[model samples]
Every structure is written in structure tokens, then in C-alpha cells.
Target: MWDMNFRRISGLLRRVDRLDHIDRLDAASHSAHEGGEGFSARHHRGVFELLPGTGLTLPRHAGVLRFGMSEREAQWAVATLADVRGTWVCRAGWAFTACYEGLELLAYGDCVDLGVSGFTAVHLHRRGPRLTEPSAVPVVLQDIDLFGYPANEVLAAVEPNLHPTVRLTPPPSPADHLSAVSLSAG
Candidate 1:
């Protein structure tokens, strides 16, 4: 199923390149005066930004868990966690987690490098003026039943640290499935 979905989306993206050719040409017209670069170059530039340095890294205490989970499951877990965490932090009346410069720089750098393929950003808020305060909310994991009885109840969980929450939302339908595939491929 995953393979089929991937193929379908890959085909669509390839089609997008063909379909957008005319638009690209039009965009290139405006750039004729600026050294005659084409639209594709402009598009690539718009999509990518270069960082001055290697960029920031997750804190020494921070860690990521990449276990024996399927790509879909990992995406779902991260997405759900970001959603719940955003709501929790918002209710607490604090700024979103991405406000930290270190985390922000790291996230943007990573996204630019990797194209933010399967990630979704969720805004988290908390009450108070102190930027360094810890969150009181606890991370939780829920079992998602992707199928019937004895379902693939993998332990999907979320961990909300000071970093901005970026996750992958579950593909709930055919359209979403296609979108997910297209995104992952890019």
C-alpha cells in the first residue's frame, strides 16, 4: 500500500514539473532584466535559503528516538503530539515553542536542507513572561488503530520540549494519502 501510494504521488510531482512549465516561462519574463535567469532558478531560490553557518543543533540534553517504527507511524506520532502540545501551551497563555532562537535556527536549517518533506508545525503557548520556564504538560502516547481488531496498536507518543513541535499528520483519506506521498517524495 505504501509503495503504491509513493509511486502515485511521485508521478504527480513529475507531472507538476511538466504542467508548471508555462507558468515558469511567464515568471522568467520578469527576471529577464536581472541577468536573464529563468523561472526555475527563481523558484529554487524562493524555496531554499542558505544559512551563514552549519546552523544550530538540538541541545546536549535533547534527543530523538528513531526506533523500529514505520514511516507512517512515526509521522502520525509526531503530528499528534504537536497538535496536542500546541493546544496545551496555548491554553496556558505562553509563546509558541519556536520562539527560541536556537531551536528556530535549527529547525529552519534542517528544513531547508531536507525540504521539510513530512513535517507539520504546531504552535505551543504558555502563560508567563519568563521564556525559560519549563512546561508542566506531560507527553502522552496513544495507540492508533489503523485497521481492524488486534489492530496495529503501536505506541504513538509525543514529547514536548522547548523546541517548536514539528510532526506529520496521519493520512486519513485518499486525498491525504496522495498529499502525504507527494510531500514525502519532495
Candidate 2:
């Protein structure tokens, strides 16, 4: 786990370094033009501002979901309703998709790095605000909110976090099966 975090940090540093080099190059080129508007420090700062997003470590905040359920507790509150669906909620501008079945947390996740692809990983992680506190690299969620955000915002927050629902297709109708049998007989 430590190695994984180290690798993530190292990758972000490399990206920041690369952006710095690019900004330097851009400034140099603009400087070469005598009368042209060279990239000012202010402008450079603004452009480089986007560079930090690549290193964003999104925090998974815990709060009542879209339906008002708090995650501050370690365990789910209701354990009887075995299979109720889950939902996403937001607070402090952060989104938390929580799965609570009858007051128990089936799962919760925050969509951070969507492009990250690797082997299946399952583990416990310290979910807190430190992840999004202005950095210079993108960190993957080691594992997998209710602010009444608009649909678009909600989708943006949770889309990356959701895995496609896995459900078996309903069995073919008995009538269809019988019809196939009759056809085969004919």
C-alpha cells in the first residue's frame, strides 16, 4: 500500500515538472518577440493553475446522502432491509456515493481518477479531505453526499464512481421455451 501511494505521488511530481518546463518554454518563446505581448507572470500563473488539477486528490466526504443519511457512523443503522439500492450525496462541494441497506453501508466511493486502470484492488482507505487539498499529481482511489446538486453535477460526481450494475437476465418465458420445443418437433 505504501508503495502504491509512493508511485502515485512520484507520477504527480513528474507531471508538475513537465508543466513547469512547458511554461518556461512558452515564456521563452513569448519573450523572443520584441513588441508582442509576452506571457506575463499573471497569465502564466493562470495557465499553470490548471496544472494542479492533474494532481488532485479528491476527498470522499461523509455526510447524509441525497436522502439524508449520515456516514459519520462506522456501521449502517438499519440492517433488516437487505437489498435497498444505494445513492449519491454531496457536501462541502464534495460528493459521496454511499450504499446503505436498512441503515448499513454496503459501499461508498468517490470518483477521482477516472482514467486510472489497473488490476482489481480491494482494501480499506482513510477517506478524508486531504486528497483534494491542492497538489501536483493525480491519485487513484485505493478502494471504493447529499448536497442536492443538479443532475449534471450529480452525474459528474458519481458517474465515474459507479460500476455497471451486474444482474442476470431474466430466464426465457416458459411459453417461449414450449414454442421452441414444438417447432423442433415439427
Candidate 3:
């Protein structure tokens, strides 16, 4: 199951790089104004890009944050981008949420399994879904604007490009809206 999801994510990465692969996304929805608010109006604080192996870049920050970073390093990374809202510790490792206004980042570290005592997962999300409102941060998965485009459009474009390994767990309907995206190594 895990391998399949990973492959699916890999497939998504490939499809996203293809130019204008999803027409609906290119249509009327691309505009922050037409769709609701353009990315410019959302007051985006930074742009984050996908990194190999469940990793992501932090704009204006020195290094990329990927799975296997130490808890301290992860916390420092998030702190540099936004305020650390809260943190939690468990038997396996630790987790925390950082926020830059409405944009939020969640990261988790693992002390066991996968043979690492470091971060294993990272996620980005809006404080809440406002349908037409733009996101505080834009998460670009390949070239697709995970938050800029409508949820339905993103899903539609992604579903078809999926490698047989991954499937949308419940298969989103035309109504689904994208609220969050995650990268994980475990």
C-alpha cells in the first residue's frame, strides 16, 4: 500500500511538470480574480516547491526541509518561516504546527521505524476553507497550484495522471475543494 501511494505521488509529480496538462485549471479558474481571489490578493507570504523524497523548500530560508531532519532542525525551519503555534511529543517522536497568519505548516518526527529519529512528514494547509478566497501561501505540486486552483480541478488533473500505484482514497467528487497537501516518508 505504501509503495503504491509513493508511486502515485511520483506519478503526480511527473504529470504536474507537463505544461498545460490540465485544461480546466487553465480556463477561467486560473485567475485569482475570476475564481475568487487571485494569488496576489491572497497576500501569499512565500512560494514552496516540491523536493525529491518527500521534501519541500522553504522560501527565503537557507535549506530544504525533508523527511529525516532532526526535531530541533525541523522546529527551527518552521520557526524561521512562521510562528510556532504549538508542539507535541509522543513515544515515537515529536510534532509541531507553525503559522504565518492563516497559512499553517505541520511536521512530524519519528524516533523509530524507517531507522531514523527525525522528521517523517510535513503538511501545508489553510486555516480554513473559504472556497473563493486565496491562500496565504501557495503550494505548487509540480506546476499545479494545489491551493490556487479549485479543489475539483486539481483533483481532476491529478486523478488521470496517477500511476496505477496510487488512487484517491474515496475518489473526490466534483464538489471537493483542496484545503491541504502533505509530504511524508513514513
Q: Against the unseen true structure, what C-alpha lDDT does each candidate score?
A: 0.25, 0.26, 0.59
- Residue lDDT tens for model 3, 53-170: 6577775553578778888887787777677765664545788888765767777778575566688767777776474544555566646656655566667676666433222222
The candidate that achieves the highest TM-score relative to the unseen native structure: 3
CA lDDT of 49 in candidate 2? 13
Clashing pairs in 1: 89-125, 92-127, 93-126, 94-126, 94-127
Give a tens-digit lDDT track for model 1, residues 31-114: 776766555532332111111111111222222312222334333433332321222221222112232211121121013344
TM for every model, in the order presented, reads 0.22, 0.19, 0.63
lDDT of 2 by residue, 12-122 (tens): 222334344556767778788665666643233321110011211112222112222233321132222123344443212122222221111222323224322211111
Residue pairs in candidate 3 whose N, alpha carbon or C atoms collide under 3 angstroms: 32-37, 32-38, 151-178
Off by over 4 Å in 3: 1-44, 52-54, 89-91, 111-115, 162-176
- Span of ten consecutive residues with least summed lDDT in model 3: 163-172
| Model 2 worst lDDT window (10 residues) | 177-186
lDDT of 2 at 50: 9
| Candidate 3 structure lDDT | 0.59
- Model 3 clash tally, residue pairs: 3
